[model samples]
Target: METRDFELLIGRNIIEKYRADRHRPAVFALAGLEWDLLDEVWPPTYSPGGELFAGRIPFDRMSSFLEMGCGTGIMSVLAARAGVERVLGLDINPAAVRNTELNARRHAVADRVTARESDLYSAVGPDERFDGIYWNPPFLNAPEDSVDTSIWDETMFDPEYAKLRRFLAEGRELLTPRGKAYLWFGEALGNPALVADLAEETGYDLGVLAKTEMAEIPEALADAFPADLVGGDSEDGEDAAWHLHLLELRPRQA
Candidate 1:
């Protein structure tokens, strides 16, 4: 299946899921923050990773927050509402930024929650730093020019893993001395070796902070990854379920 069609199918699935639960608003509450997600933004249906990430956040204390790829701004809002000093959300998709800003307004955190259009940290100032950074990056590695990039595809597939690696490398620069960065990761995305090497070379230590099993796998995802890496169900039954994890990455000691 072509990437365009695959992404369209995923979009359709999200719409259908939303319709099924139309009676209940797409509102998620965690860490004392309630998020009202827009239907047009990245659907948070199969997004347990977001909740897991939010749960790991330190609610008792305040810190600056930076969320890359902040879809609908829920994470940023959660941080702001949790009393984080300041929060900024960045995304490549303009609609995501708009949705984030709107959500921030609705949540009455507009003063502290700022949303902007950026690919990675391009829009961030060189001197800026944060006490906390959050990312649930596009995990699938897509071939260059293999698919017509759509919002759905762009949110799900990381072409050549270039952006993922770049984030792993450069994100450290924006972290304060006592700051920590969190990334939601999955075993199905790519070779574990690739992630391991990147973490090592980037001078970060990757540690699992939380984990959740994936309940459903979209068809488009299957096509994007090889059979062996697409799902956690292997013949050996050793790893029967794919797990989504919140990874804590801290700078390695020299």
Candidate 2:
């Protein structure tokens, strides 16, 4: 798709909630080039996670970045759009990888952005290190047996804490010196102890950036997700909310 069409496809949805204050087009700074990317509604099939992931990674000065489970490659493309020297996006889905590549081309960042089909870290070489890494694991209120294991399984259905543990084990090698790996997770799975313990064991200093008490069902995704799983007092504050934590993880050697 052309850059204009691609930008129009995703920008529209983002503007509704994100750019309500701004009357002009929603501008996205990509790889040193500021583009009028958000002026229209989003694509028909865009997932709910697109805006959430994009909102987490600030437009900071970073030479290299890696986006794990980059559906549609939006986050990776946005990173490239932010002037990051290199942006690598990995996903297990073929269609997602293809869409990522298409978005990269549409944004004129194909030369700098890469989206590939592989598990986390499997697609890159050992020497490949990134200055910034951003990921939003799949954390919904479901068990492993009840849920299908997708890239988002890290957050949604990690009953045994296997996925988080694996990432902690190898995170050191993937991050460069002074680099930071930002992870968006929630306490809904009832595994904060496990998460903290694994981080401590791996010599990572974990920190929570922000915790939003979001309603289990946002009316948009309510029909798709089971309501029983999200039956909590979101409005009353006593209800269980999916705590979004931006963990700042660093390697032991660093």
Candidate 3:
């Protein structure tokens, strides 16, 4: 199927799913950290991308940790628990900010975790730096031509992949001299050209630190995703499940 057709079909599936059941509250553990997340944000149970991202964090504590698009604030709380001196969670949705704050308090990390509403790095201060930064960016490259929109859909759609590239470019600036950045990249959700261009533009070397098998895609979205890209079918049957990879990015040598 064509990319446009595929994107629209995914968009329709997202809208339909959101309208059916948007607010689902659940408790779950990720990378040994317990999370009580509202369905208003991305659910960590069905979605293991966040958990996978949490697992790749360095064992040693850092001075500061920055998390962008902190849906449900799981990573921020986990970062605080990991002994980061300070933790800042940024999200464009006010509800996400509030959710992170609540989660931080619930996890007894409120003292170190600060959640704020910001579109990527816009709200980050000029001089601020972090020893570690993380982002689980919106995956789907869906077009924004649809008339209907909702908060839940934000997790699935990226228009022209603007935010994805912007995050890579601007996020590079927020890293401390010794800081490292990580992003969750699903093979199916991203295009090679965009990824290559972003890496070149930022002058950063992207490396895979870890990977996790993603949950099964809903049957409703089957047609929207290419079977080969999502790893649903193969003669060998080894690549049956989709995988989310943790990418560690750092500046190239001079």
Candidate 4:
């Protein structure tokens, strides 16, 4: 699908809509591949804000890597281009897992990268580890409407910020000493301070790589970026939610 086909989410709210042609199939362009993903749930696109944050990090050559929460496999493809020998993209959703696999083939990196349906590190071998890792965790803090169904957050809905904290804690075991992790975070939920605390509590060194304020949303994506994703935007005569912060992470080895 064309970039114009994607929509936006604006204002500070828990959930929004992506009125794209859901039936046409979902695809994302990453590192040259426009791989088709299962859109039974919404598929993620690289927005200007997200891309800008992603562009800031100076990824270094690494022996092997892992990308948790690899939605649409966009970041994973970028890691592959950065010269990682092998990369594993892991997520909890089956649809996302399938999408990631297709995207890897689209970039002709299927052999170099793999996608797995895993709840955190459940599927990973206890002995498995990595030199470098990348993650764009679900960092939004919004109250869920009901605990009934955990809607796929590909569209950036507000849910308890549980996944990120868990990753910060458990991800340490997966890192190889001298290893580094490239983590991108959207500060819509006011998470900079919280992330810092988590980093310290988890015993990892923190580094702020890139950050930008949520200025304005495009006409199209006014409903996709989600108010909770970009600090909320109002139509007129009022201010929207304000947010900003993005960065990478390192596993402390002292």
Candidate 5:
């Protein structure tokens, strides 16, 4: 599929799903833990990315952690439960911040997990640092002139990759000397080349930690786009199901 067509189809599907399910609050279990998702907060039940990333976090290696764009504090709470000493979850959406707080308290990790409304690193203290930082960013490049009119829109779109650029640049300053940062990106749904370019430009070496296939596209979405376009062998002969990439970012070796 053409890039524009693919983006439009994905955007439409995201909006439709959000509209259909935004007001519903529910509890979901992932990796042996329960998370309470609030209305308007992105739900892990809809996308497996959060659970996937949370499971891969090296909690044993980190004393302090920061989770950017923490929708419902799933990873933050899990990290604390796994014995990370301190976990801070940040989100630009007020609803998400509150949802994270709710889940933190729900899991009895309220003392260890802190949620704040922040646009990337804006709310992070300059003198504070974390042993690990991670984000499942709004990776889609929204069409020009697009304005985020809703929290769902902010969750799904990042116009011109602006937020991503800042994330890579600013997040570096908040990491301890031995700390590492991770980004969970969907190669099929995001611009990977741009991600590489931004990582290099921001003085980081980007590498893959792990990856998994999405496996099945929703029947509704499959019908909207060409069958071959949505999922099939890629130009490199790799299955398109292998889309979600858990990427690792480290400071460039001097």
Candidate 6:
């Protein structure tokens, strides 16, 4: 499918799911823990991408961890449970920050996990650094005009990859000498070439750590998606499969 058509389909799926759920608060179970998802916070139950990415984190290798765009603090709490000494979760959405804090407390990891509002690294302390940092970013390249139309848009779209570029550029400064930045990206839905360009421009080497197949249309919005776009058994078929990649970014050697 054409990039524009694919983006439109993703936008439709996001809008339909948001409208159907109306941003209600609910409890969700992930990684055998109950997370209290607050209103207007992105719902992990709506998609398995976050949980799948969270499972890939190497908690045993890190003493301190940071999770960017932490919707419900699932990864932060899980990291603490996995024996990471400290975990910090940051989000641009205040609701998400609060939701993460709620889940941290809910899981009895409040002392070790902290959640705060941040637009990428804005809220991170200059003197502080993490052994591991990761983000499941807003990967879709939505049109500039469609941004900030709703809170849900913040979770789904990153127009022109402005935020993504900053994450790659500015994030390097906040990492420890041996630390690595991990990005959970939807390459099939987003512009992978632009990502590669940005990573190289920012002086980082990008490598794929792991990948998994996810449905192009989220399960909750599967029925709402246009049937015509759903591909079938033909040589020219375009199946509804998208790949989510866990990418490792290391600062380029001198």
Query: Which lDDT tens digits does candidate 5 get at residues 1-254?
Result: 55755675677676676666544558878767777877777766666664566767678989999999999888888889889999999998898999899988988989999989987788988787998888888766767565455677777788778888888888888888988888889877788788999999999998888887767764334543455556577778977564788888898866
User: Alpha carbon lDDT of residue 56, candidate 1?
Assistant: 77
Candidate 3 residue-wise lDDT, 73-101, digit = tens: 88888878878879999988888898899
Among all candidates shown, the one with the greatest lDDT? 5
| Each model's backbone clash number | 0, 15, 0, 14, 0, 0
Give me the overall lDDT of model 4: 0.62
Ranking by TM-score: 5, 6, 3, 1, 4, 2
Error of 3 at 87 (Å): 0.6
- Which ranges in model 5 have alpha carbons more than 4 Å from their true place? 22-25, 218-239
lDDT by residue for model 2 over 13-65, one digit each (tens)? Answer: 33333335344434443334343333232221222442354545554758899
RMSD (Cα, Å) of candidate 4? 6.6
What's the lDDT for all of these models? Answer: 0.73, 0.60, 0.74, 0.62, 0.79, 0.79
After superposition, candidate 3 runs with Cα above 4 Å error: 59-61, 147-150, 218-241
Query: Lowest summed-lDDT stretch of 10 residues in model 5?
Result: 218-227
- Model 1: C-alpha RMSD to truth? 4.8
- TM-scores of the models, in the order given: 0.79, 0.69, 0.84, 0.75, 0.89, 0.88
Local accuracy of candidate 4 as per-residue lDDT tens digits, 164-213:
67777787888788677666665543466777888888888888776665
Off by over 4 Å in 1: 1-34, 59-62, 190-193, 215-232
Residue pairs with clashing backbones, model 6: none
- Superposed on all Cα atoms, the candidates' RMSDs to the truth, in angstroms, are 4.8, 10.3, 3.4, 6.6, 2.6, 2.6
Candidate 3: the clashing residue pairs are none
List where candidate 4 sits over 4 angstroms from the true fold: 1-16, 19-25, 28-33, 46-59, 148-160, 218-221, 224-244
Please give the ranking of all candidate structures by lDDT, highest first, separated by commas. 5, 6, 3, 1, 4, 2
